[model samples]
Target: WSEPRVWPLPNVWLGVSTENQKWADVRIPILLDTPAAVRFISAEPLLGPIDLWNVNGINAIEPDWIGGPTAGTGCPHP
Candidate 1:
Protein backbone atom coordinates (compact mmCIF):
# COMPACT_ATOMS: atom_id res chain seq x y z
CA TRP A 1 0.00 0.00 0.00
CA SER A 2 1.08 3.52 -0.65
CA GLU A 3 1.40 6.00 2.20
CA PRO A 4 -0.90 8.96 2.36
CA ARG A 5 0.36 12.06 0.68
CA VAL A 6 -0.92 14.20 3.49
CA TRP A 7 -0.30 13.78 7.18
CA PRO A 8 -1.97 15.75 9.98
CA LEU A 9 0.87 15.34 12.46
CA PRO A 10 3.42 18.12 12.76
CA ASN A 11 6.15 15.59 12.11
CA VAL A 12 5.99 12.49 9.97
CA TRP A 13 7.81 9.25 10.76
CA LEU A 14 9.15 6.81 8.22
CA GLY A 15 10.84 3.55 9.08
CA VAL A 16 12.81 0.76 7.49
CA SER A 17 13.72 -2.64 8.87
CA THR A 18 17.28 -3.28 10.03
CA GLU A 19 17.10 -6.75 11.44
CA ASN A 20 20.52 -7.61 10.08
CA GLN A 21 23.54 -5.90 8.59
CA LYS A 22 22.58 -7.13 5.15
CA TRP A 23 18.98 -6.05 5.53
CA ALA A 24 20.01 -2.63 6.75
CA ASP A 25 22.45 -2.34 3.88
CA VAL A 26 19.67 -2.95 1.38
CA ARG A 27 17.11 -0.65 2.99
CA ILE A 28 19.33 2.31 3.91
CA PRO A 29 19.41 3.63 0.39
CA ILE A 30 15.62 3.72 0.14
CA LEU A 31 15.45 5.53 3.50
CA LEU A 32 17.95 8.10 2.31
CA ASP A 33 15.82 8.92 -0.71
CA THR A 34 12.48 9.06 1.10
CA PRO A 35 11.38 12.27 2.80
CA ALA A 36 10.30 12.30 6.41
CA ALA A 37 10.33 14.63 9.42
CA VAL A 38 12.11 11.84 11.23
CA ARG A 39 13.47 8.75 9.55
CA PHE A 40 13.85 5.62 11.65
CA ILE A 41 14.73 1.94 11.53
CA SER A 42 13.33 -1.04 13.39
CA ALA A 43 16.39 -2.88 14.60
CA GLU A 44 14.36 -5.55 16.29
CA PRO A 45 15.77 -9.05 16.38
CA LEU A 46 19.08 -7.52 15.52
CA LEU A 47 21.15 -10.41 14.19
CA GLY A 48 24.44 -8.56 13.98
CA PRO A 49 26.13 -5.21 14.40
CA ILE A 50 25.17 -2.52 11.94
CA ASP A 51 28.03 -0.43 10.67
CA LEU A 52 26.51 2.70 9.19
CA TRP A 53 30.10 3.80 8.66
CA ASN A 54 30.32 1.85 5.44
CA VAL A 55 27.90 0.46 2.86
CA ASN A 56 27.79 0.62 -0.90
CA GLY A 57 26.01 3.81 -2.05
CA ILE A 58 25.34 4.62 1.58
CA ASN A 59 25.19 8.43 1.89
CA ALA A 60 25.75 9.15 5.56
CA ILE A 61 22.18 8.06 6.11
CA GLU A 62 21.26 8.51 9.73
CA PRO A 63 18.07 7.43 11.42
CA ASP A 64 16.30 9.83 13.73
CA TRP A 65 15.36 6.89 15.92
CA ILE A 66 16.09 3.18 16.13
CA GLY A 67 14.00 0.75 18.14
CA GLY A 68 14.29 -2.71 19.56
CA PRO A 69 16.34 -5.88 19.43
CA THR A 70 13.00 -7.39 20.56
CA ALA A 71 14.69 -10.74 20.94
CA GLY A 72 15.16 -10.21 24.68
CA THR A 73 18.86 -10.59 24.12
CA GLY A 74 19.63 -7.19 25.61
CA CYS A 75 18.78 -3.55 25.47
CA PRO A 76 18.87 -2.42 21.87
CA HIS A 77 17.64 1.00 22.78
CA PRO A 78 19.00 3.55 25.22
Candidate 2:
Protein backbone atom coordinates (compact mmCIF):
# COMPACT_ATOMS: atom_id res chain seq x y z
CA TRP A 1 0.00 0.00 0.00
CA SER A 2 1.06 3.58 -0.65
CA GLU A 3 2.02 5.93 2.17
CA PRO A 4 -0.71 8.23 3.46
CA ARG A 5 -0.70 11.78 2.16
CA VAL A 6 -2.04 13.23 5.36
CA TRP A 7 0.84 13.80 7.76
CA PRO A 8 1.44 13.88 11.49
CA LEU A 9 -0.01 10.45 11.98
CA PRO A 10 -1.79 10.00 15.28
CA ASN A 11 0.29 7.16 16.69
CA VAL A 12 3.55 7.26 14.76
CA TRP A 13 6.60 8.98 16.15
CA LEU A 14 9.33 10.10 13.77
CA GLY A 15 13.01 10.70 14.47
CA VAL A 16 16.43 11.24 12.98
CA SER A 17 19.91 10.19 14.10
CA THR A 18 22.99 12.33 13.77
CA GLU A 19 26.58 11.70 14.76
CA ASN A 20 27.56 15.35 14.37
CA GLN A 21 26.55 18.76 13.09
CA LYS A 22 26.98 17.79 9.47
CA TRP A 23 24.42 15.04 9.55
CA ALA A 24 22.14 17.04 11.82
CA ASP A 25 22.07 19.86 9.33
CA VAL A 26 21.29 17.46 6.56
CA ARG A 27 18.64 15.38 8.29
CA ILE A 28 16.94 17.40 11.02
CA PRO A 29 15.02 19.75 8.77
CA ILE A 30 13.58 16.92 6.75
CA LEU A 31 12.43 15.17 9.88
CA LEU A 32 10.85 18.33 11.25
CA ASP A 33 8.87 18.99 8.10
CA THR A 34 7.57 15.46 7.84
CA PRO A 35 4.49 15.03 10.00
CA ALA A 36 4.31 12.84 13.07
CA ALA A 37 2.66 12.63 16.45
CA VAL A 38 6.11 13.14 17.97
CA ARG A 39 9.52 14.15 16.64
CA PHE A 40 12.91 13.41 18.14
CA ILE A 41 16.64 13.59 17.59
CA SER A 42 19.17 10.90 18.35
CA ALA A 43 22.75 11.91 18.78
CA GLU A 44 24.07 8.58 19.77
CA PRO A 45 27.71 7.65 19.30
CA LEU A 46 28.18 11.35 18.94
CA LEU A 47 31.48 11.92 17.18
CA GLY A 48 31.39 15.71 17.31
CA PRO A 49 29.49 18.73 18.53
CA ILE A 50 26.01 19.92 17.54
CA ASP A 51 24.14 23.14 18.27
CA LEU A 52 20.45 22.38 17.94
CA TRP A 53 19.44 25.95 18.70
CA ASN A 54 21.32 27.30 15.73
CA VAL A 55 20.08 24.83 13.13
CA ASN A 56 19.12 26.30 9.70
CA GLY A 57 20.06 29.77 10.96
CA ILE A 58 16.35 30.28 11.73
CA ASN A 59 15.74 28.68 15.10
CA ALA A 60 12.44 27.69 13.60
CA ILE A 61 11.76 24.33 15.20
CA GLU A 62 12.74 22.11 18.11
CA PRO A 63 12.55 18.36 18.62
CA ASP A 64 10.23 16.90 21.21
CA TRP A 65 13.15 14.92 22.63
CA ILE A 66 16.95 14.77 22.31
CA GLY A 67 18.78 11.65 23.37
CA GLY A 68 22.41 10.63 23.40
CA PRO A 69 25.48 10.08 25.56
CA THR A 70 26.13 12.45 28.40
CA ALA A 71 28.67 15.21 28.17
CA GLY A 72 32.30 14.35 29.03
CA THR A 73 31.38 10.73 28.51
CA GLY A 74 30.62 9.08 25.19
CA CYS A 75 30.66 12.31 23.15
CA PRO A 76 33.99 13.75 22.02
CA HIS A 77 35.06 17.39 21.96
CA PRO A 78 36.60 19.30 19.11
Q: lDDT of each prediction vs. the true structure?
A: 0.60, 0.64
lDDT of 1 by residue, 7-60 (tens): 424466776767667888798889767766666666655666676655443323
**Compared with the true structure, what per-residue lDDT tens digits does model 2 show for residues 25-53?**
89988986776677777776566767775
Best by TM-score: 2
In model 2, which runs have C-alpha deviations exceeding 4 angstroms? Answer: 1-6, 55-78
List candidate 1 stretches off by more than 4 Å. Answer: 1-10, 54-78
Q: TM-score of predicted model 1?
A: 0.55
Count of backbone clashes, every candidate in sequence = 0, 1
Model 2 weakest 10-residue run by lDDT: 57-66
TM-score of each: 0.55, 0.61
